[model samples]
Target: MERRPRARLELSDRAWQVLAQAGGNVAVLHRHLTAAGGQVPSLASLYRVVHRDLEAGRTLPDRAVVRRDREERHTRQAMADLALASPRQGDVAEAVLRLPRSSSTAASAVPVGESGAVAGVGLPAGAQLVRTPSVRAVAEPVGQAMAAEGAVCVFGDPGRGKTVAVRMALSVVPAVWKVTWVPVPVRPSVAGMRRAVFDALALPGRFPHTSALADAAVAGALGEARVLVIDEAQRLPVPCLEYLQSLCDHPGTRITLVLCGAGTERALARLPQLASRIAAWQEVPRLAAAQVAPVVTGFHPLWRTVPAEDLAWIDQSCAHGTFRTWAALTTHLQNALLTTADTSLDRALLARLCQRVAPPL
Candidate 1:
């Protein structure tokens, strides 16, 4: 008999599980296999195994790099807790957090009970929800534009959660749409602003000048994205804002253009043509006491560790109508919790935390 080919090896279910868990790290696989009473295969053999599994559709070739901002991290945990607590209707937004980005680049699904780091107790709910009448009034029209191809403008008070809402929308929208979120830096020079848009769109950096760059970037995004959300759009000088108006000139391209910023209404007023093109517009306002419960719920568990009464006071003081201040207070509270592990937050501790606030941005 022709020398029997060395018996071909077939990985057991246990081996496949180990490989999948390692996400194709060959070194890890080898170690696991050797420890499991199997000989460590040569690199070439390992490669074949992976290749074969991929060809057979047994494994995904690439793993995802998942990162979540603070509010989102909390929303994810809450949704998970909600899911286990009551399995009926899940929080649609939280489901998106858990989904793979490639599957839903803008939307993701968050796992419950992963950790308290992201969804701690102290996060404010108003930052996460669009509770303002102005925001609620415009959300549908904005959602329609997002569903089609175009953009909407969200202008509001500083720290009123303009950025937060835009992010939350991305967390809820369908995956087929591409959501490109760019926050316009404060007082950015015309040139720098254009560069930021280009980077967000992953376009080439070189540009003739600021004006040309703005014209090109908006047009480029309109050509590709389902929706382009520009946060802090109020900072864009008149010239750039006017150029942005041109992006929606053609109704056929199907692009949603969202312009968001503090006091954006004044900026939009200057661009008559762009303002005219705006099918919908609104000014998001600061959070109210009714909304404090949601904000408190969203705060990471670390925030919850602080006594409720102390948090109530901080909320009342920061409720002076600024999201930035609210954020600072939360950070201060987080630091206090980390260093002291003192769950019993009081008015005195609040005073110490308040000291950390930068003279009201």
Candidate 2:
């Protein structure tokens, strides 16, 4: 059996900050280490260390600066202390119930990457829940399933705000609805895919075979009204998608399945049966150039730090369009934000950040 890595390093002050900002990417951790005048670890080794920390439920060490006010400091302490204490949908539901109240002025807002979800998000005016045709239709069915049972999937492009929209919708749900969010794994194989979903749901059983396990899992899920929202649904193989389709079969299941992805209409062509069974389908289009400004204006403050020209480029590129590309560009701008002093992005800065985060197109 392969042994898990055991090497550990005492993180520096800057390392903690970088880890907090990077979320969980080991590549970013290595970059921050090198930038902070430390020897860099190999990619594999760094990943092992980061994964170990995550598994052990460790968070950034307490800082000595003590810069925050009493409330903010208390919130940070609580967050750190409760790092690994939150339960899943069918579990105790502590984290969802005890979420920190939104500050009148947020201390910092993090950007959502193509693969990650953004918190404290807002929808653009025309994209509002009441006005947007696509979003409005999708929201009702989703809200119904959520009220009946917590948890559901809102599959879509990486930065198309699938997660954001779900978060918004859940906010309207009653407190009795226990909401827990996790990113859907985008693995390729059937077995690997099953493990991903099982691990995500934190289900109790395991299977030696992927097919058998998937059927059993879906059967069990269909008995309850719990919504399992699978984002990036296009990436799942045919077998995996079929299992989701099976959930629609049970009437009492009330399991609402929302699948969002780039070119979803085209992607669904590959699964005609599953596609036809979908009760509601919503197309989330990229914001047009004219629509980008208002959207950006309504974005979280940290996002505002991105230069206007960069936002314009993002809007244009996304309009062309691809969620994968938009997500990559957003990560670049976020890294730039950490170093910028005047605290806003510039065209040159945006260009440089883009180049560094993504390859030449």
Candidate 3:
């Protein structure tokens, strides 16, 4: 792709005067433009002019800041060249992301990679399963609880792989079961959760006005063997939690509720009636420092050739033992590789990779 220079905005002389009065501050200029009764364009338009002026040395004080910002913007996009995708679409959001129940998955017995080879994620690309300790810990128990007609709660810090762990559990579910995933709304309500379940199950007609009628309808839809997977349960309101509890405890309803979220225990504690019904509670922990290299090596091709010491430094500097942090690091690293075509991963390169996100890496 050929690079194109941004079209500069020709602001009025009065606008430039206001900008100068504001000391090259775009926000202040925008405010002044609004206050002076001029038909001001959007803030973004003002930023473009300021940025354009700074780039050509029209504003020296703001130049250093704008240049650093521009450098980071480019750095963030650094890895677009290497992204490979195997796209397939299914549920918009499954309560827990799972391999379709029809797909057969061989349990990955491959221990975390110890070999320093520069190949890829070792596993076949189309393999249905992505096994890890956290996934196993979550999958096995949730499966057991659902089988026994019990409720389970999985909680942990944000981005600790709670959702992935649940997906791993869902892979082995027999085809006979109907699993419903109800995502909690931003501001949870009893009515919202009921509607979400009703929508997932494709129940007949709109949600009933009465809670009892809605509960009965949902229970009927979820026959003898069913699982309700609730992601982001921490955001669910007390009434919403109680509503799920009603379904879980109903003798006629053979529904097993698996709730995954961060701070779910604390949230559920406020709803003691709902909390008491939970048969199992597990916390998904972040990856340890020692396990970073093998995990990264198995996750993608980009990190396979990264040296062991550099990998550990990456784990410390940005990964910070969290799955999401590792993901962030990998994204930046991929862009870095694409940008510079670096032959080998080095400390300086690693620091540069995370400069946009962390403090001086």
Among these predicted structures, which one has the highest lDDT?
A: 3
User: Which is the better candidate, 2 or 3, if ranked by lDDT?
Assistant: 3
Using TM-score as the measure, name the better of candidate 2 and candidate 3. 3
TM-score per prediction, in order, is 0.56, 0.47, 0.62
lDDT score of residue 209 within candidate 1: 61
Better of 1 and 3 by TM-score: 3
Per-residue alpha-carbon lDDT of model 2 for 1-361, expressed as tens digits? 9999976665556665666555555678787677767477777876776677767887653333332233334533433343212223332242222112232221112233311222444432222221122233345656544433322334445455555555444443333223333344656665665566566666666654656756576466455334456656667767766655655665545454556555555656687887776654555555455545434433433445556666778556443433335445555556556666675455676556556655457
Q: How good is model 2 by TM-score?
A: 0.47
Which model, 1 or 2, shows the larger TM-score? 1
Clashing pairs in 3: 78-335, 79-335
lDDT of 1 by residue, 1-361 (tens): 6987787656677666556556667678778877767466776787787778779888643433121233334443443343222212355433323221123222122333333212322344222322233333445556655544445677766776666555544544444456676667677765575666667777665654657656656575556446677776777888677545555674434467888777777888887777776766766766565444444434334444555565666667644656567666766676676788645566777776776674657
Q: What is candidate 3's TM-score against the reference?
A: 0.62
Per-residue lDDT tens digits for candidate 3, residues 1-361, read 9889876567777766556555577798788778878567799977877788768877433555555455434422321211101112132122222333212222222223322111122232322224556766776667667656678899999877787667545644544455677867889677888888888888888778897888888888775567789988999888888888878777778777889899999999999888888888989987876666555565555665677888887777776767766666677766666677544577777777667566551
lDDT of each: 0.56, 0.50, 0.66
